[model samples]
Target: MKQSSTMRLSRLVFLYAAARLAVVAGCAGAAVAGVRLFGLEVSLTWVLLVGVLAGIAVSLLALRRLRTRINDEIRIVDNRRQDPSKRPRP
Candidate 1:
């Protein structure tokens, strides 16, 4: 049904967002820790910037499967919208 598809899409979006945020946070924490461990002085802004950039790069490789699934689900929903026959009956 359209409702189920929409719900699934929503769930996937939530999961992706949570996963991305966790990765970014983890990377940011690591960046801060690494700086302290090496006794290197760096601004918080620069460390956070590096963390966010690294998180994006890591997510591209790590979340490819989840991203593909999300894209496929989006295409399916879009197709259903364009074709009345594919739309669920109330």
Candidate 2:
């Protein structure tokens, strides 16, 4: 039963990672798309700069989200531990 839950959790983690990568690529593509729409000449430097910036932005947001979630979980655990009924009696 534990193994089944671990596997499911791992699958979700992998999918979320893949989705983030796709988002970074999509942001880069959007930059290129904008250039093409305006009939501007494509530049390698421009594409790379835009892509790198987008990836950094996404990574920072992800880290902030993860940190917030972890903090919230810790509070939940601490609150549960502080409850008298939930405590183990010696």
Candidate 3:
């Protein structure tokens, strides 16, 4: 029932969050490496800021399918919740 579906939704959300965090970290590492490769100095704070922005952009494209699936599932769950007749029996 609702509990099972909710758990599934929670898992999807957790996966999405983890993916975003990983991308952000990867971007930060890349930023650091890129700067060093050019023999340029940059503040860590600025580099992290750039990384987060880049991560957001990349994730918006790369994670589109996953995001869509999550949204669809949320919509489904919400519909079921709003329509008591559609809700599963305990």
Candidate 4:
């Protein structure tokens, strides 16, 4: 049997969280490397903070996109399950 929309949504949310974490970590690492490689004077704390914020923004955008797509499918499924007659004609 296929998973329920709620379960699928939960999985997608978890993946979105993991991706955000990775983005934050990668950005921080790159910032640190850039500072060291070029002998630039910059605070690691600021760099990491920026990275985290950017990651959050990116994740929010992705989440919105994913939610929109999944919601469309979920709605269609619910409509069909609740009342066959209510479903849109193909």
Which candidate wins on TM-score? 1
The local distance difference test score of model 3 is 0.86
Tens-digit per-residue lDDT, 21-78, candidate 4: 7877776777777778999887888877877787677666756777676677677567
Q: In model 3, where do residues sit more than 4 Å from their true spots?
A: 1-3
List per-prediction Cα lDDT, in the order shown: 0.88, 0.67, 0.86, 0.72
Residue-by-residue lDDT tens digits, candidate 2, 8-88: 445555655676677677778778777888988879678767876887687668656654554565565577577888665
lDDT for model 1: 0.88
TM-score per candidate: 0.91, 0.51, 0.88, 0.62
Candidate 1 TM-score, C-alpha based: 0.91
**Model 1: clashing residue pairs?**
none
- Minimal lDDT window, size 10, model 3: 1-10
Candidate 2: residue 35 lDDT (0-100): 80
Native-vs-model 2 lDDT? 0.67
Q: What is the C-alpha RMSD of each candidate to the true structure, in Å?
A: 1.9, 6.4, 2.2, 5.7
